[model samples]
Every structure is written in C-alpha cells, then in structure tokens.
Target: MGTGTDTPHGARAHARAQHGTRTATMPVVPATDWPDPPCAAGHLVWAETVAGGGYTHRPVARGTEIRLTDLQGDACAHLLLHSQARPWERLNVADTVKVQWNAYLRTGRLLLSDQGRVLATLVADTTDGRHDTLCGTSTLVRNTRRYGDGAAHSATPAGRELLTLAALKNGLDARDLPPSLSFFQGVEVRSGDHGDGDGDGTLHFTGSAGPGGSVTLRAEQDLTVLIANVPHPLDPRPAYTSTPLEVLAWRAAPTRPGDPLWDATPEGHRAFLNTAELLAAKDPS
Candidate 1:
C-alpha cells in the first residue's frame, strides 16, 4: 500500500540529500588576512608628460602634503589647484610659503590651510631654490622644437589639459571658460588697438570635446599678465576641435632662465620674480 504513494516522497528526499551534499557554506576570509600584491615599479596609471602637462582632480584635501622634487637641476615645475571640480587655479607661491613658514615656526611642522588644505610643501630641493608659478608648464611644441620632437622625446600629459578633462568628467562645460584659457595650440596677442582688445594677452586652450557637449582644455596666457589664461565663468562652445589634424604652434618660445619668454613686460616679470623670491626665502629647512 505504501509502495506507490511513498515513492514520490522518497524521490524528493533523495533530491534534497543530493543538493545538501554538493552545497557547503564556507567562512569568509578577512581582508587583513589576505593582502594584495605590491604594484610594479613605474606601473603608474596616472603620470604627467612634459609635453602634455599634469593636474589634480580634487583639491589637495586638507592635511594632504605634496612633495615636489626638481628631478632635473634648474628645472621648473608648474602646479595648479582646483576646489570642488572647478577650474584650475594657480597657487600663489607667497601664500604657500606663508603657510609653510607659519607651520614650521609655530609647531615645528608643515603648514595647513584654514580649510585644512595644505598646498605643496617642498620636502626636498636638490635643484633650484624655488619654483615659479608665473612660468607655467611647457607645451609639446616647446619640447619638440627645443629637444627635437623625435620619437626619443619623453612626452608627458599636459597639466592644464588634465585639469580640464577632470572638470569635464565631473560635469563642467568647457565653453564656459574665458577666452584667456589656452591649450594645445598658441594664439597671438595684439595690442588693444587691434580688434583683439582684451588687456589680457592672447589665451590658448588645447584639449578635446565630445558630441555629448563636454570639453577638455589646456590653456596658457600670453605675456605673463596677471589675468592671462585665467578661466572665465560662463558657458560657450570652444574655439577649437577636441582633436585636430595638425598640431598648433607656440605663440612664443617656452620660458627658460634669461630667455626672452621670461622677459615679459618688466612689470609682469617683476611680480612673478618677487613672488618666486619670497617663496624661496620662506623655505623651511
């Protein structure tokens, strides 16, 4: 009497037994117990090229310390900062030094901003005594012409472009930047008498844009004016394509010590020179 009726229940029990045999719960291992392998040397996902430049996405968060080393003696490295994914803003060398000095003198420690922001701190300086903000980053063309733009040239991504791309990725409009933003190629700055009458020297911005209406920018100011290449607040389509067939030329040769490029109008050069000197004087041991 039970043979046929109990057969279904027996099959179900057998299926359950098979499933339990195949499935076994295992304990999870703690992350600390299993550490990841060390990264390979020079296996950097992010690196700045001299020709292209470099930039940071977020503000050097409060308490962050950046150590700048003059890889090559007398070589100048340009640094820019941004807050909340806004435009890249130049850090006043003097402001940076004051912060550094106050920190060292008061606490025998490095400085920090009111917002807990710590700009770059010169941990070591084997090269030049100071870095120049006025003398911005060099471009691809500048390196090519100076070092023979051959395959052997070591190219770096432009910092300005990196900043622009970072902003765009974070949802900023490229066209909003003021005309002073210069990138990829250079533009000519004419006296106000000419139709191009902005007191600011010609601005050049180099980078790409997408059909989705985003832009990347790498810009430079002409003549080292205070207002040169400053990002403007407004939205407008960019002047150049995201990528072009031919490379643009530099408006002037890259800045080098004692070069005409550094000899921008006496007043402009003086402002930058003074700032550089102040920064050097405030250097903490």
Candidate 2:
C-alpha cells in the first residue's frame, strides 16, 4: 500500500502501470472559460444541485463525457443510470462488483449492467478513488435513528427521497430501485466482531473531497441518469449538510483504439468490444 501523502491505494497512474490501463483523475474543466455554461464550445449539457435530499434527472447519449465536480468537500452524489432505450437495463450494482472483482470503484473501472453490457466508465476521480456502490443511498429510518426527524419534507430530507423522485421522473413507479453509486464517498470494509449483532462486519466511510476536486465518466451508452448530493449513510458528519456538486457534459469524441477504459481489464476489453459492435450495428457510420 502506498503512503497516503504520495500514492493512494489503486491510484489512477498506478492502476494503469500495474494493469496496462489508464487510471488517473481527469483534469478539471475551467469554469472560467465556460462560466455561462453550455460552454462557448457548446459542450456543457446539464448542471444542477440537490440540497442534501433534493433530486435531479438527466438523459444523455453515448460518447457524452460528463465531469462531476465537488464544489465543496462533503458532497456525496448518489447516482443511478438506466438505459435510454430499455429502462429495465439499469445499472446493476451487484454485477459491476462481482464481474470486476472489486468492491470499490475508481477511474478505469467500467460500470456494468446486469445484462452484461457496459454502461459507463469511471474516467477520472480526484477524490482518491473512494466511491462506494455497496452502502447505497441513505434512508429515512436510518437517518431518523442516527439523526432525528429525517424526512424528505423535513428540514433535512433523506437520501432515499432523491432516488424516489428521480425514478418517478423516469416514468417508473420504482417498486425495485437498484443500489446506487455514491460518488465522492469512501468506505473501508473491515471484518471483525462489529458488535452490531448482524455479523455482517462493518463499513467505515472516510475521507472527503476538496473544493474543485472532480470525477469524470465517458458514457459508453445513452443513459438515463438520476442524481442527488446526499450524505453517505456512514458519513460521520454531525448534520445532513450536503456540499454543492456540479455536472458538466461535453460532446465526447469517438473512442480510439487506445482508450484507457477499453483496455483497463480483460473484462473491460470484452465489454468495450461488445459496446462497439452493438453501436456499429445500430449505426454503420
């Protein structure tokens, strides 16, 4: 394990060197140049903030690269992606972890669907590669137990409300909302007698993002995205204050032969090939 100061565990450059795949936080897009947004180059697609429990929904197409910036340090964006073509083909959290053989996600990891298709790739993460997919969105009961009066309509809304509202906008009743990816959140899994009585061990969510630190993902397929900047359930913070986060989407160029995500892993390569073939069959040009 590299020292926290010099190299973090699974640092992007290290991931690339060891795995023959690129992994490093992508550069931050200058907010100065695109202050008015939608950029002078016409790339910015969508931007919004959900205060703690607020929610927003977006639909973006393939080859669209979106950058997620942490305007403040304590932001935790609970994200879910569904297929624009087939909403049923949403982000399958379990498949992503099991197939990739990783519990934590960072730049260079591919988000996989339950149907064995590539949904998106984590291109850059400035938050020390600490995103979580297991802990999932925070809940009312858990929040109420941990911090009194946790409700969507309450002064401090719950994280689950974000997913519920976003799912509703997607035209589904959301009887089964899948687990979500918690960006800008870090969770360390430990095995021992946690004393919680569940015998499931314990998860300690640590670390926080710095202002302007960001993550980026290049869409491998057209995606129906739902977002909310809610705190992680394991967040040790006293209040439900959510840091403001930003999203910037630009028209992504075509993927080249040497794309990092395409070569990140054996499974990643296979998934990319499958994606390319599918997209090509859909449009030969």
Candidate 3:
C-alpha cells in the first residue's frame, strides 16, 4: 500500500499503511453479481445492491461469511451490528477500539460488544486498507450544512436516519442506535499549517475503494446488521453523491481454535468463549 498525502481533496494526514489479507472461510459465488469477488471461497447466501444514499438491513447467522464490494470507486458502507438474540447487545465501537488498542481496523481485527463478546472480524479488506471508522457517516444536519437541506433524504439520508429505520425493522429504535463502523473510506490525521492558514489537526477522507476492491468479514455471532450506503461524513465530492454497494453472504465452516479469527489475539479467544456460552444458553444444546 502507498502512503496517503494531504491535498485539496480529503485524505489521510499521512501516507498509506501496509496492507494485509487473509483466507476466506466460504466459497466465492460468481453468478450472484459483484463478479470477481475478493474472496476465493464462499457460496452466495443473498446479494443486495444498496443504492447510493439508500440504506438496508438484514439478519445473518453466526457462522456466515460476508463480503462487501464497491462496484464503483469511492463508496461508503456505514455498518452496525447487534446480537440477533439480544438486540441491546450490539456493536460497541469504543470496545472495538479499546480491545484492539488501535483505531484503524485491519484484517484480523475483532469487532467486540460492550459485554466484551466477539461479534465479527475483518477477515479481508481488498481496498489496500483504505476503509475508515473515523470519518463516520453523514446526517440530516450535517448534510444540510455541508450540502443542503434538500440533499438530506434524496437517496442518501443521514446515517442516523437510515440506521434508525433499519434497526426499527429488527425491533430496535433510535436509542438503540450505536456508533457505526465505517468501511470503504479512509482518513489521515494531520497537524501544523497548510499553505492557506493553520492546519491544526485534521482527518481527510483520502481513501477510495476502486472497482472490485472489497472487504470481507466473518460473523462470530448471529448479527442484526444495518448498512447505510451513504457518503462518508468527510467525502469531498462536488455534490452529495454516493455509489451502490454489493453485499454478499454465505454459510461458513465451524471455527476452531486454530481458525484465523479465533486465534487473532488472546482477548479474541476469551471473547469467543463468552460468545459461545451465550449462544449455548440461548439454544439449550
């Protein structure tokens, strides 16, 4: 991967970070659309194209493997995860950041819950690690100020609105909304002055997911997933524009201690243990 630079457009304050990859647990499905998926293995569960600015939601099994493809360059998928059995126990971005001790999520990073359970893992990111969790998603207020009020609900409503509706479909409401994990966007932090004036510290959306560039995840728990196919909060596009995203899911093989995600870290191991206990109690099996 190449380092990013600060320019008139949004970008990370620094250059690119070294990229990483991992094996997929499912077979690739070429017929389901988003041809030439990044993952070599994974059968298609179902595929959906979230129109730019539109939002969608779905329920996925614990062992399902997921792939998100940016059919066009520069797309954002603001995602949130929740336990299918317990809606309140959803993704905790703070826990994910603290447990990993890194703000940037890469392949092998665990997405944890507030109860310290593993939700999912970033098994692959084909955009050379250009995804971002820092810039977040755009909202009505934000879009109105940055673009205009009319731009708020055209196709890409604020992430909050989309997520709220997505969650409501799964028996959750606004208060249930959690901070999301952003993908297909990358940001760089910068300080000091640029040519015009004081630069201070700033994060620029310098990352872009080129065509066929993809990210894949393996769900460690049954997940109620919300997706916002909206522009990244920091996108510098001339207009409030976003591109469609193709989401693919497949059945996954049972994970063992030797699995990539299971052994990613000592904390991951313990987190899975907790998740297993919770699932077992729910199943009585």
Give per-model CA RMSD: 19.8, 15.0, 13.9
lDDT per residue as tens, model 3, 1-285: 333454622244332331232123222234244354434444566566777777777899887888888888756889999988888898998888887777777888888999999888888888877776665666678877776652435544688778888888989998988789788877765657667463666776676857777888888888888998788887777576788787888777546567767877887888888887887888876
Task: Write the residue-wise lDDT of candidate 2 on 1-285 in tens digits.
Answer: 663436666475565565532222221334234445643465666655445456667789887777777777777888888888888888988989998998888778888888787888887787887678788888878878877866767766677876787788888646647888888878867666667653465677765756777888878899888887778888777877676777777777645569765686888787778778877898899
Estimate every model's Cα lDDT from 0 to 1: 0.28, 0.74, 0.75
TM-score of candidate 3 on Cα atoms, chains taken together: 0.79
Q: Which parts of model 1 have CA positions greater than 4 angstroms off?
A: 1-59, 70-76, 85-124, 128-130, 139-159, 170-285
Residue range 1-285, candidate 1, lDDT tens digits: 233335887667666666523211111122122122112332212122122122323223322222222222212223344333233433344443353432111111221222333222223222222222222443435434444331212333333344445456545544422222222122233335544465465433221222111111112111111111211111123321122111111111222247342343443344335434533565534
Q: Note the clash tally of each candidate.
A: 26, 1, 17
Evaluation by TM-score, superior candidate among 1 and 3: 3
Better of 2 and 3 by lDDT: 3
- Misplaced by over 4 Å in model 3 are 1-43, 150-152, 191-201
TM-score of each: 0.28, 0.79, 0.79
TM-score of 2: 0.79
Error of 3 at 131 (Å): 1.6
Judged by TM-score relative to the true structure, which candidate is superior, 1 or 2? 2
